[model samples]
Target chain A: TQLLEQSPQFLSIQEGENLTVYCNSSSVFSSLQWYRQEPGEGPVLLVTVVTGGEVKKLKRLTFQFGDARKDSSLHITAAQPGDTGLYLCAGVGHSGGSNYKLTFGKGTLLTVNP
Target chain B: EPEVTQTPSHQVTQMGQEVILRCVPISNHLYFYWYRQILGQKVEFLVSFYNNEISEKSEIFDDQFSVERPDGSNFTLKIRSTKLEDSAMYFCASSDQGPYGYGYTFGSGTRLTVV
Candidate 1:
């Protein structure tokens, strides 16, 4: 089974609408990161939440890390067409030695139509 | 800000042929990694190279897959014999010492299509 799971495989909303995507896992993560990828481009870092219960905001996007460090959420307020892209959540595991490995979720394809 | 750069943005090769994908990681980064994403699938880690050798690798990185740092500035992933299933977007990433608070910076990616 895939180590990480992301819900709402797809999302579509009109401009100014709100939407939320989720990432869940049975194992705890040392840190979680949210990224956005445009078609034909590499994913771009959005936010990284390290501490449990941490909440971070970047413009209209808000990211939250679960208390158990096993889940995360990204909420977009007043979504804009510019927000259309593939959203992916990656968990950084703590196996050993700086633990640079990252396990990625299946991803959520989001479309914000104007 | 420094970024990872991968070459041969797009490569097309016939199945069973040998192919080499090249990447130039950030000058100051210590960790180097290669990842690939099949169409519509999640990005998956292939292998990681550090200190002139491999540190970790996923099961997908089979014997056919090999990595080498031929010089001070280049890291390359070579496929002894490519297969149709090998078609995917391959990305190279690098990180500074922190390797935590700061997320990995990935290259534009090389789109490999095997026929």
Candidate 2:
């Protein structure tokens, strides 16, 4: 089974602090996606990284995919209370034919206190 | 923005009872999927549907589980016999192209509690 291991399962920081979450896997994937989920709600897509060593930025959130497509990272700058949530990383792979599947990480729970 | 809509935000049922979780995928999406997340556990893929048939499914999707796109816009998942272990947050998702084309858009999810 392909598994995505996420580091720093839980993190707490004061406002304005910076934090980074890591997702690693032994299997290579065609693409990787990041999602943030709030309580009582489903996960909301944040960003997707398709190319190896690719980097994309959204406001204060920076996402990077590893050169081997086996890992990814999310770095949040100047974190605020609004950024607090369960951050999940999912690896996308083709099962067969046109069918694709997403294997998710356990997720990192972040809490930003003002 | 378009959204995937799921019905009955929460449900409570007795063991061995049947339950159907309903969803309305995006109007333009062609691929549909079902996933479940147990409390304090990671989200796990259950099944993928396309062309009115099951394209792929995980081992967790056993005989007790089934999916149907009953109408043009609605996709439904039915569990014939609920087990305690089946209790989880079930999410329905759809993608316009494929996972590689555009990432899946998920619903708010239905929390199933088997008693």
Candidate 3:
């Protein structure tokens, strides 16, 4: 199984501050996705990156996929209180038809204090 | 927007009892999945069903667990016998496309507590 390592398990920042969460892995993936989960709720899909070196933006949130397809990052500019939640990175690969599920990373808990 | 729906927001059952978690995937979705997360842990995939059959399953989904799409709209996960370690949030998700596609939607989840 492919393992995704998410860094900075917890982040507490004042509103309007910028933050970046990282998810790294040694195995390449065919696609990478980011999801935000609130307390007591299932994760909501934020974005998916398929191409290597691809970058996608959702308002103040910027997501990037590494050229090697082994790492991804989520950068929030001027974070708001509403952005406070658990951020997760998941990857999917079908190499040699051996794996076909979304392998998730241990999430990064971000708290944007108001 | 269309969404996946799960019932029994929370359930508490005795160990060794049979428990069933129900889900209603989006109307048009063709692929359905079940995932679980222990408190403060990463989400773990349990099984994925497509074309009325299981496409994939994790080792964690052993003989005690089973999944079925009884009707066109409902997907269910059954635990033949529950264990204390089975306590966790169970999420159901559906996708219009296969694993390679991106339009996956997840339900709010059902919290199962085995005592």
lDDT, candidate 2, B1-115, per-residue tens = 9999999999999999999999999999999999999999999999999999999899999999999999899999999989999999999999886856365899999999999
TM-score of each predicted structure versus truth: 0.95, 0.96, 0.96
Candidate 3 lDDT at A52 equals 94
Candidate 3 per-residue C-alpha lDDT over B1-115 given as tens digits, one digit per residue, 9 for 90 to 100: 9999999899999999999999999998888999999997899999998888999898999999999988878999999889999999999998886655488789999999999
Better of 1 and 3 by TM-score: 3
Question: Model 1, residue A112: what's the lDDT?
Answer: 92
Mind giving the per-residue lDDT tens digits that candidate 2 earns over A44-111?
Answer: 98998888999999999999999998899999999999999999998888332233678899999999
In order, the TM-score of chain B in each prediction is 0.95, 0.97, 0.97
True contacts kept of 3: 0.59
Name the TM-score of candidate 2: 0.96
Task: Give the lDDT of residue A7 in candidate 1.
Answer: 86
A92 Cα displacement, candidate 2 (Å): 0.6
Query: Per-residue CA lDDT of candidate 1, range B1-115, in tens?
Result: 7788999999999999999999999898878889999998999989888898998899999999999999999999999789999999998888776455364888999999999
- Backbone clashes under 3 angstroms, per model: 0, 0, 0
Query: Candidate 3: misplaced stretches above 4 Å?
Result: A94-100
Q: Tell how far residue A113 is off in model 3, in angstroms.
A: 1.2
* Span of 10 residues, lowest total lDDT, candidate 3 chain B: B95-104
User: Chain A alone, model 2, TM-score?
Assistant: 0.93
